[model samples]
Target: MLRLVLAVLFSGALSLPASADVSIKRLFGKEQRALNAIPQTHLVSLLERSKAAKVSSGGITYSRDWLAGQPKQSGGREWRCLAEALYFEARGESVKGQFAVAEVILNRVSSASYPDTICGVVHQGTGRKYACQFTYTCDGHAEVIAEPRAFERVGKIAKLTMKSAKRPLTKGATHYHTKAVSPYWADKFPRTATIGFHHFYKQPSRLSRN
Candidate 1:
């Protein structure tokens, strides 16, 4: 009697599900084919793009979309100084790189070794030829802003970076230079993150006369 009941139940399950089985298999097949059509590299690229689009609580999003959502920003001398520094030094860098440069400047502001303000940090060694902290200031050529759009973007970055609560990007970096040349001071300071064309550094706490 138990054998007969088990046989009936098995036969019933087999006989009633043809349409259901086909539907389930077809749906799974379509999804599998869709996934298989995407190349592995392409999938990885998509994941990276998605992560870039995410707005972080740290207030530094590396996506143009995040910048577009921000209101137009403006400020006085300090803001202008930071904006100009970024434009001349890192306008062509990636968004993350520009922020990294800004982080270095801001970090200098908070450190005892450098000036407490953005403008002061930027123009620390101006007025003498080849002696300025920033080359653009002492380069002798006119600081003509040929690219207004690029300047505007850096200006926005400057504004946001100033208002950011923390400087986590460069880890309190106080100095940075492009990878093109190994500056005399590069070996002295501890190397930090290297972003875009620049390598960032943090000076020793006591500071050096170089």
Candidate 2:
């Protein structure tokens, strides 16, 4: 059953749209509109930074500029726990992949064994030396948004996720891994979802479900 489902998702691997991830739709909340809503000031030469801009996904349109006006980060003014998770969790991945990883995180947030908040879930594996989760943040490597085009694209997806765009791709998964590394944990986990090169799993959420 898992193989059949995964094959279907992987075969039609087009760029995922905002309407594809359910957890994202619940978080972003439907305020994001307009293509050129705002300019990327952080990327402007005035800030001595590179310029960032929006990209259309063939027939799909997004609100990258609009999101620029809402600078949410882990520590920034618009700091949304989910938004921060999306930025760092999969910033290096394609927009769809980034969102895919984020859905896993959100799935965890809503699960019974993990932290209810995104920050807690993200930082859960931190400070354990080699025992931390989300290998990218604890691997002694800095997270840099080097690919501006891709980052901008993911950033927009992040914004859309914050604005209630729904696809529910992760199926309440709180864990994930890239296809390249066949982590031992993968063998132990019961797969919940798979999108692109990522696989998601659930180990329960921490929040009390009414």
Best by TM-score: 1
Q: Which ten residues in a row have the lowest lDDT in candidate 2?
A: 43-52
- Tell me the deviation in Å of residue 208 in model 2: 14
Residue-level lDDT of model 2, residues 25-137, one tens digit each, is 44334323321243554323222212222333322222334444454433332335455556666665544456667666666566666677667777677777876667656
- Candidate 1 Cα outliers beyond 4 Å, as residue runs: 1-58
Alpha carbon deviation, residue 126, candidate 2 (Å): 1.4
Estimate every model's Cα lDDT from 0 to 1: 0.80, 0.55
Tens digit of per-residue lDDT, candidate 1, span 50-114: 65633355556676557667777889999999999999989988777888899988987887777
Global Cα lDDT for candidate 2: 0.55
Error of 2 at 158 (Å): 2.0
TM-score of each: 0.73, 0.54
